[model samples]
Target: MTATVAAPDKTRRLVFPFTAIVGQAEMKLALLLNVIDPKIGGVMIMGDRGTGKSTTIRALADLLPEIDVVAGDPFNSDPQDPELMSDEIREQIAQDLPITITQKKVPMVDLPLGATEDRVCGTIDIEKALSEGVKAFEPGLLAKANRGILYVDEVNLLDDHLVDVLLDSAASGWNTVEREGISIRHPARFVLVGSGNPEEGELRPQLLDRFGMHAEIHTVKEPNLRVQIVEQRAAFDQEPQLFSQKYQQEQIELQEQLIQAQKVLPEVYLDYELRLKISQVCSELDVDGLRGDIVTNRAAKALAAFEYRAVVTVDDIRRVITLCLRHRLRKDPLESIDSGYKVQKVFDRVFGLES
Candidate 1:
């Protein structure tokens, strides 16, 4: 089998700054939360075309701080994360050899719509096998996405089998390839960001449930906000570098905040009472399983950390409850109510609006 990786667009020398995006606060927050605590699983962004879904994702990807990676490692394996490193790398570390370390742009790999399983997951190198009579593995998109974001546009339209593979890898934090009588496994942990148009197709329940948060966005209706978005795009189109330079300071500050949030995340505490409250809200919403409650707890803590707070609060839980449970709730065929509205109703009933 043969495959190719999605290369970054070189034309985009300066991505539209994340701080410059005019609207879609929920989408921005969900991305930021995942960055702070990748254990929050990933985010699913559902909206119509031209809703800034892709733009925001790419901008956020460019906004992130660069990461230190083990040089010559295809997976961007962290030197400290032994479990995620290959045996050869560990041996080099053990030998105290002159280990070359390098800084690399955090990976933001794209999963094109028609990509095959061999492209998403690694495959055997046929050329090396034929030339040298050796079995060698060529890493794919999943490997490239390690310790970074794997973006899938129009995710709902992807092949079901491919979706299953992606879901399994996201949940297990590893991808194992058994091709051409050769077996290989490596850490595939990544923050999965998927954007799709619900009008085209619906995502499978299993895959939907795996997403820690879901943000539903719509076109900006406010005339002024729409104008601001247009003006920004026009400026970006006219002079990408100049437009980026205008927001460089804000971008730097935002990056610093993300770094600080990661440092504070471990110290943020979630108490039992709040945990129980989160469960109560999930239970009231009739969420299918425990994942809703668990995700809410995790997202809340991450939100607090993003705010530089040491303790989780009722407000923190409320802020994230919608994103955590909106996609996980069991839908009522007879009811026309919005899922987000239903989540808010449950929140109000369980904890009250004032609380």
Candidate 2:
């Protein structure tokens, strides 16, 4: 069964085009980096509601290239192609013959807040057993999201148990099951995407650390920008196809850029001086755990890749500091200034990315 939102006003629902979205440039940049490097963990967007969080994610889905996946595999594993699948999976599939595949837009499976445990994780196919006396396992959200994205809108509201499962699968790249007389483990690697209003609740620290990057955003403030958003959105509702068509060419261009960036990412070089700076910033902030340094380095590399540069620059590092380090830092909310700016001060004294 499909979930429905509280509101019935459906025709007016238009995802603001990536090009059309005003402001929030930082948020957009962080998301783009995650696409270039899935190992950056995953992106978690925190902000007030109606800040174009979900819309931005959906827009990315439209912008990204569809990937090839095994035709009947619930986990969306790649077929036995040495170049496409990882060496481990490639070897596993080599023993199996006649693998099949088709292109699919990396799935963005929305996990509803009130979903049952059985629904989130697979359950035995009781229908198959009752009717045919044969035990067949059924897959769940984790399985369906393999090689794609798993999105949680009100992520902070999710139960701890569900969050635990998400962490396990995300860290291991496989979802393990020992339920209902069936044991299964399959590849469940996915980009775990989440968005939430911080006012509602706090995301668990353990789960929060799982995300590769973090972006903070809010609705447009300037009246002109706000007006433009409303005007374009209304125009889109007046004629959906025409509005979408106008932006179609731009989306295609963005897609091409993304493809080029992906191809160039591995070539982006990181030197020792930059690594030392990243560690110094994190250490000064008193942010525990080494994930902060790892994420900062990864995010910087991704930004460099996006810029079509072969070397990661100080400019790239500074551009990504806020989103990558904000949540990880131990800070007092009373301080109006953000940890990113603090890192910035140190950066200017050291490498001078900004004037």
Candidate 3:
């Protein structure tokens, strides 16, 4: 008998395609909505280690379309989006605009596990003035994320102050700088995608509400599935180009689905009963505030649109309720997952899902 040797794994050489990722249905849905309705805020994935949480998000940038942006701006705002312009700049655009544009990939700028406050938020250009006697406002990660996705892995571990900066900028859609006698404003609107292992610490409730959806991803332990994953991944490591070529068709098909979904999303209808059900479920669960209602509606509408449905339904809402409510649930003094599962069970009874 002859023994064959196996090739080494090389998952880091290239980003795995978003379409190629398996499982984590809610996570996938939330991200899809971020693309369809950037106003739904951002997707937050909280889960266990080795669950493919980060991989799914990193791969998403691959499926998005290239955007047209102003030629000189670091924040890649759409030349046409009004938020991109200052009042004066808006006037200039209004007055027979001289808007120069170029198409670029929608960015998925990563906030490293540990980054300084000054670097994450823009700071004044002291070096420019000290050396050349000229003042400048250097952009930061927040600025570059405009009209893109700002991704933070291990988000719960981020400094509280930095988290505040992110939330405020996200809510306002622009960064305000007031330091070193240089005050400036620029577009900072971007979907904030945060992924973390929940065992470390819980994200603040106020901050949690800001995320439009939350998905809990767990590792796949199935024997057959795991075997396939390892084999395909090892094959790709031995032949990168050939592997990507094989999935080229799959990527194209997924991209087409996304584009078609985007077109229909604007016209997708939210039914009256669905709206009532959303309110009822939120109240039943005793979840705080109105963001829950808003996110539930948005996620359901987006899910329907993704599935090529023309109208929202209970099924759509049920699929996304956990994603919208898991992080926003009021804290229990006892500390348990029951509060979350209880809400989900209530939703099932009211909305008619598998009990």
Candidate 4:
């Protein structure tokens, strides 16, 4: 699953290392699990502004190992996997033509707030197609994000319709564009990561529920930890290369760990009793749909895999259940209780853990 790409340009800017991030453990854990199993859907991170949300996500994308892609293909087409290939690549395969393979860093696409339907989903040149007798298609952000990560900052502020389009593509692993009866479909299997400041606004419950996991973060309050984070940032800014070098080994180790976890994920399993308990907790929480149950199960298994285990443990479920179910619980304007706390209380009761 890992590929080796050409050496990075020395002049390129260095990202803050993921392993070097100060705190926000919950956010980091949710992001890692999603990477391990994109089928778990994606993670919605709600936090205060300047809480390292964007920093951590960018570091994660930089942390991931390179991937194999078809040379000259805009979609990062996986030459060997049809599910991740573009229509043009499939046709080339059908003709039994040779494919040129290349390696590149996993793409990380930032979805802007003002992005239009055509900007995100690409456009079809109907006139060009009709006149030239060919498919005149321009690839979009979704195409560039294929087999990579699609990041939406301030997702809560994004238009609901745009959010729907992103979620639909994330879930279905494909994007279709139709214009003047000319249709084009391409693979768009990417981990959808969205981060926002809760103070701004909240996404519709329906759209929020579609995200696989939700991580809530706050500004670091500990003086020592805050000082350390600030110092680290200052150091990185002063000597980017030297600072990055200090944590290069840890980054490499984490990259290897993520790759191993992804490979081990398919073998990881959750017990039947645990499955029932997960559902029971969801039932008690009155979650609107089965998404909470499904995401919890998937995230627990992913955690087990991350730890190099084939069987899920209570600790695994305990760690991820809140992130998986917190946003799914119905909201009450008059109730001030934290949704995560409510989820934990229900989990402990259903799993027979002492409160």
Which candidate comes out best when scored by lDDT? Answer: 4
Model 4 bad stretches (over 4 Å)? 1-10
lDDT of 4 at 335: 86
Scored by CA lDDT, what does every candidate get? 0.87, 0.77, 0.78, 0.92
Better of 2 and 4 by TM-score: 4
User: How far in Å is the alpha carbon of 40 misplaced in model 3?
Assistant: 1.7
| lDDT for each residue of candidate 4 in 1-97, tens digit (9 for 90 to 100) | 3333453455667999999999999999999999999999999999998999999999999999989898888999997899999988888888888
Cα lDDT of model 2 by residue, 1-355, tens digit: 1121232233544455676666788778877888788778788888888888887887776577877775556766666434335333565565654555566667778889998877877777766876887656678898887777788888889898898788778767777667556565667787788888989997977678777778888877899999988898788778877888799888888888888988998888999999998888888777789988999999998888888898998888888877887787665769888766776776676575457
Whole-model lDDT, model 3: 0.78
Query: What's model 2's lDDT at 110?
Result: 85
Candidate 3 on 1-355: residue-level lDDT in tens? 1122232344544667776666677788888887887778888888888777767777788668767776665777566678765444466667865656667768888998688877888788877866886557777898888888899998999987888888788878888887766677787888898888879987888887888887777777788877777777687678867877777888888778888888898899998877998899888878888888998888788888888999987777777788888777778788755655877788888878754
Each prediction's TM-score versus the true structure: 0.93, 0.86, 0.87, 0.97
Better of 3 and 4 by lDDT: 4
Candidate 4's C-alpha lDDT?
Answer: 0.92
Model 4, position 60: C-alpha lDDT score: 95
Better of 3 and 4 by TM-score: 4
lDDT of 1 by residue, 1-355 (tens): 1122333335646788999999899999999999999888899999989998988998988999878677778988877778677666777878876556667778999999999999999898877877898768888999999989999999999998998898788878889988666677888888999999999988988889988899999999999998989998999999989999999999999999999999999999999987887898887777887989888888999999888899999899888999999999876789899999888888887776745
